[model samples]
Target: MIEFALPDVGEGLTEAEVVAWHVVVGDVVEVNDVLVEIETAKSVVELPSPAAGTIATVHVDEGTTVDVGSALVTIDDGAGAGDVETEDEEPLVLVGRAPAAAEPRRVRLGASRPSDPPGPGPVIGHRTDAGPRVRTKPPVRLLAKRLGVDLHTVTPSSGDVVSRQDVEAAAALTSEPPVSAVADARETRTPIKGVRKATAAAMTRSAFTAPHVTEWLTVDVTRTMELVHRLRADRAWRDVRLTPLVFVARAFLLAVRRFPEINARWDDEAQEIVVPHFVNLGIATATPRGLLVPNIKDSHLLDLAGLAHAIDALVQSARAGTTPPAEMARGTITITNIGALGVDAGTPILNPGEAAILAFGAVRDMPWVVDGQIIIRKVTQLAMSFDHRLVDGELGSRVLTEVGRLLSDPGETFLHV
Candidate 1:
């Protein structure tokens, strides 16, 4: 019999909630066949079988959370079905035989200590004879270190084990100093455990780790808006919702083709640069749960209508909180539509691992030079933030300029090249 242990799905995920099961006992499964769908802290991931076998038992049921090393399924190899032995019979060893047993090894504690040991110094109640010290666990230690709190100063009142609440209390005390103020306002605190927590850590890591450089440019998107208006009236786009975001996505793809370096990542461990040939276009979306950047696979290969369909599907999945984990991984580039939130323009941060991110601002009627005279035109601002280590100033400028050019002259794009 062979037992299938849950594989490590992604980076440092210890456990996952079994959202669904596709196979049951006595079911024959092939290698690479999806057996179950699990939800980790990052996203929903599908677990596939490793080998072809007949499943003997299902260890976990739907909606149950399982650890990483736990047995998920048992498969029967049908090799030793009739083998049986009595209790008096000795078990056979794979090797010839075991050697004679030897005495066990043991170490004596405090055997080499001096008579008069060093004092505990200024630490109070730190007894040397108190069997072992009661402190936080490994995870709690990491949390305290991240929060910049000295664990020695924390008062442990919750018995020997420190709970998450204790760590949170330590964090709160260390984050803010003593301040005296009159209570005149009511404030509510929301726990950051789910998507909000993950997003905050990612943004903080990206901001501090990468040297961010942002460039802003105002563009006349009159032609792009006109194209959107015309497409909305067409019969093909009748059922489809055409917005400025669609045009922005297409332009970003075109820019990526022109500037390939912008769609690359710096692999610090391997001492190599990874430039993806295909574009997994990530659309930064604001959902009811939190901010998510679920992406569309091979978005650069999709045409105008295909891109529209892909964007619509991704947006709907994100809003429903059913976006798959595989779709969110290996994103080559990203675009955030700050324009949808009625913002003119703002600097955006690069998605972790990606070299660049483009921010599309709100399009509004603004004065522009037309035939050497100022006229009201549909204008929008484009902000591009890139990692200086991977993308230089000239490459960033070229990518942003290409996106702006495509938007300014949508019809000319087809005629020029």
Candidate 2:
């Protein structure tokens, strides 16, 4: 029997919520066949079977979040599969691809003897004081144990069965006030997990650790709008979805090239300001799951058309919640387009480990003075937030000024390109 424990899918990932299971007990599976889908703090990923076999037992149910080394399922993969030797115990074989960082717990399977008859216990449906003997599954019981929550004290919101949510809610009340502490009866409690929880933790760390300074610049983007119009008219560019954001991204890349220091990180351990030649430009995207900041790799090397295409693809993938975990990692700088939601401006927070982030505000037609004459011009507000530990006021101002200049006049952008 091959015990399949949940593997660590990415760096620093300790646990994942089981979104679904494709194969149940008694189902046959081949190597590399999709076995289950689990959602981590980063993204939703499908895990494949490491060995071909018939699934003997499903240890975890859907919607249960478990640690990396927790047993997920057991498969009867014939008799030839090798086993890892252990001290004074029966030979056990775990999933081949399980991360070495987390060792699967040794599980003793079945009864010690055939006549033992499933151990001595009060059977299910046997009545107790608190109705039907506190109905719950193994996974829920395990969760309750981990959270220091007693099942008898939890009230089941969904029918009679105690769910994972119930366990989490009960735990929340004991620690830092969440479910039971609500003052209003109309309020609903949501367990923070997956993307929401990850975002909160990251933002909190970034806010407290880094000294953030945000600068704003409102610029006349008439020339940038003209460039967009011309691109729309061109037959070659018709296939591409051209927006002000594409221009903003292109301009930002140019500015980063001019001020590479803005595209760097502060390594406190090494006591160094590390600057990489390549730029992984992150685009902040809002999805059904949560806010995701998936980035494009080597964005500095891409031309305007390529950059546009890359941004489109990245945003689409992020919104659809299909973006790979790697795409969301290693971002040098970030851009959040609050304009898409019609917000005028915002002081955005820096993505953790990134030196800077740009928040592009909504474009509007406003009166401006040109050669001592008032005229209507296309204008937008640009706000940038940078880590003051790495970027001084002058450097941050220069980067923002360069970006504003490129947007004000597209010809300058072309020359820089």
Candidate 3:
């Protein structure tokens, strides 16, 4: 038997959470078959099987964090059951860095007895509270059994390894009859990990680490709305989905060109500013997993039609949870559409390592003064948060004002119709 261990993923990933298991025990798999799905801090990656064989056992449960060198699965490589050995002696085999990395090398440590399932956490031996069998002291296991709680379904309050506390919490939900508990009400506690946990840590650090100064501008976007309508009617843009946001994105790129400093990052270590010549415009998107900021590389170079296609592809991939890690990193600036949720505006948090973030509000009909005359116009609010260390009051204000100006007049800001 061969033991497949987690390999070094991109960006020096020391550990990853097993989001799911594609193959269970006793399933026949082939070389390069997708074995599991893992979520890193940056993105979700699918790991492929290294060798073709029958899956003997899975070392860790779904939603369990694992180190790189730890064994993940064991395979019957047709070498017979006697060929099994320990993982330390044999070198782990792995492919290139693109796909999720896992060091899959078979070492036959022999199978666990029928009564004992595979160990949790690392493959060697341990118990965890994730998806597989729940791990705990003998007394806690007895408590779970007595309370009729399926150890597999119970959530652990502490480490991946289950504790008596986790079992007690699980028992509390049923400590009282369900019908009676419904009247009393109860708190459903969800384990904070994976994407949700990572997002919280990142947002918290971003909010506190940077001195953020947010500015807002309400703009009359009547012309921009007209442009969106015209583009939708045009056959030339039939393939691309053109919304008010396409124009907003283009306008933001133009504004960045006018004020290049806004498309830069603050390098505190060097005590200098680092500016890039190209723009990698990040579009903040919400997914079932969490909020992801996947950017278009060299966005400034794309025309209107190209930009629309890029935005659509990026957003669709992000929503599908397939956005690659490369696309999420090194973003110069980001734009989040709070309008999609019927919100008028928001102060969006900046993506870590980026200079600024802009929030696009919903476009709506509102009372306006057009040349000293009362009129109803299409309008939206633009709110931006910038790192005060890199972008001062004057520069941040200029960027927001420019974006508003471009939306106010499409012909002046947008290129290629």
Provide TM-scores for the models. 0.63, 0.76, 0.74
lDDT, candidate 1, 1-417, per-residue tens = 456666666566677766555665545565556666666666655566554555555778654668876777765444333432121133212123233322222213322223213564332112233234335543344345435555566677677676546767877865442221223348534445446667888899999988999999999999999999988898977887678998889888988888888999999999888999999999998875578888889988888778888899998877655676666777789999999999999989888988999999999999999999999999999999999999999999999999999999998352121
Model 2 residue 26 distance off true place after TM-score fit, in angstroms: 1.2
Backbone steric clashes in candidate 1, count = 0
Task: State the C-alpha lDDT per candidate.
Answer: 0.71, 0.79, 0.77
Highest TM-score: give the candidate number: 2
RMSD of each: 16.5, 9.5, 9.5
Model 3 clashing residue pairs (backbone): 2-106, 3-106, 3-107, 7-102, 84-108, 85-108
Q: Which ten-residue region of model 3 has the weakest summed lDDT? A: 176-185
User: Can you write out model 2's per-residue Cα lDDT over 50-123, one digit (the tens) per residue?
Assistant: 66666656778666899987888776666433562111132122224432222222223322422223656532
Q: What's the ranking of the predictions by lDDT, best on top?
A: 2, 3, 1
Flag clash pairs in model 2. none
lDDT of 1 at 306: 80
How would you order the candidates by TM-score, starting with the best?
Answer: 2, 3, 1
